[model samples]
Target: MEKKIRFVNGEQVQTIGVFAGSETLRGYRRDVATITTTGIDYAQAVALFTDGAKWSIVEVGEEQKEKVYDWSSHGVAGPITDNRDGTLIIKMGKNNTVEQDLQDKVDTARQETAQAQAVTEALAGQGVATVEAAQAMRMMIENAAALLPDSEAAAVPSLSKSWVVGEAVKPGDRRYYAPTGRLYKVREGQGHTTQADWTPDKTPAMWVVIDIAHAGTQDDPIPAAKGMEYEYGKYYSDPDDGKTYLCKRIGEADGGKIVLHYLPHDLIGQYFEEA
Candidate 1:
């Protein structure tokens, strides 16, 4: 209710009447500096600042008096009283959570960096593999991919035959990315079975690949067919369980491990996998 200098961060003030100057108030961003020698009592000081139009200033009350505090950085910090004391009584929390937080952050970073380094070293050693090993891996992939009928009928390992499972894809069955972005079919039983095994409609229930890109919302099923589109054999949500039908019309997502439709809503369930 009365006038007083507000606490703020800035250089000390020396002028007296200047505190009341209209221009002075505009120039000041925060608290006005009052010399300890003002000799005005708390009530008197409050009245002065109030009259000067300093609505922001408030008189320091008994409750606001400084008190002795034990700080982590400095032992016993300050005592309650009014005076020109430069010292600040920092009350340190019994448990120095700040220190613990900093330590935890440092430890986490160190662990992560160490793990990365270890992985890098291990992989660095495997930079080069034998031609035989490469050939063996090629054979295995060929076998797996062979299960899927290749549309191009491309030779093995030459980007002719792709991979798929019975043409229809299921949720979580598997996703693959070939060197070439061609559509390959995997064998049936590798993907999900549609909820409705009804006869083929006008479309013959051909599978098209679709990516939901996310998991369905809390109340809704996942969405599918978010990103790129492609042709596939069968569309399914889960071939193993045969619980749901993502979509019969395949986008570009099926065959490898992508879905045609994200079950409940494609937008809601889009990309829920990577995250």
Candidate 2:
């Protein structure tokens, strides 16, 4: 069984459904309404949540009707199908692990369904033009985007072990290990990559060592020669394997606008600070 953290001092947000746009954009307005309230500072936030601990866990809803495009070939050449039932419950709170985060996947799916319904509803309305319909779709996409966290989410608290819950950063995922001062490689995405989720020791000490499975410049050919140290906000892909990874100069990815979905990896290392 995987481990998860339940926060001692955080708040949860009850949501409201507010959909913008007439005709086409009239679909799920409530999805955009879910809000969050957090009590922990940045480091603790990052240590516990994927969105730098924004704590927003989207529980997906039921399946709503979907318009068929050439690409929407029943889960073929289209966007990912997270949840289709049509109910969405998004929960943002201080969390413990990516697996823990998965517990709320249903909520996010619900949000998508609701928003999708809103779009279809708007499109079905009278006098809805193509542009208006497009706008409604954009609104739904925007709702998803709004879930992101802010900038300060990456900041590490000085002289303390900030509890952070992160997504699965594996041993093989493209990452930069600061402790080793060498970037390693994970050729296949998660398929070939073997990694354990990140967890800081409950008992703390002095300095922390963060180990990263990294990706270096493909142009360099050799990894050690091309292996480099990360300062902050540097994105790179492995040359031999064509895998991508990024170093959080600030030390993490927050639910904030700081998105590294483009970056994948499960990084683990240690440090000693406090108990």
How well is each residue in 1-275 modelled by candidate 1, as lDDT tens digits?
Answer: 12233322311211122121111222222222222324444444333333222112234337575322111221111112244443111111112234455777999999997776565446445532455754565566555654644322223334223333344454322223353332323324334443344211111133333234323332333322323232232332332333433322324354444433333234223422221
lDDT of 1 at 36: 35
Give per-residue CA lDDT, model 2, range 116-200, as digits (tens). Answer: 6676666456444466776675565444433432222112112121223343433333232333343233223332212234322
Question: What's the TM-score of every candidate structure?
Answer: 0.23, 0.14
Q: On a 0 to 100 scale, what is the lDDT of residue 116 in model 1?
A: 60
- Per-residue lDDT, model 1, residue 207, is 35
Which residues of candidate 2, in runs, are more than 4 Å off? 1-99, 126-275
lDDT for model 1, please: 0.33
How displaced is residue 111 in candidate 1, in Å?
Answer: 0.6
Backbone collisions counted per model: 60, 74
- By lDDT, the best candidate is 1
Candidate 2, after superposition: displacement of residue 121 in Å? 0.6
The top-ranked prediction according to TM-score is 1
lDDT score for residue 200 of model 2:
25
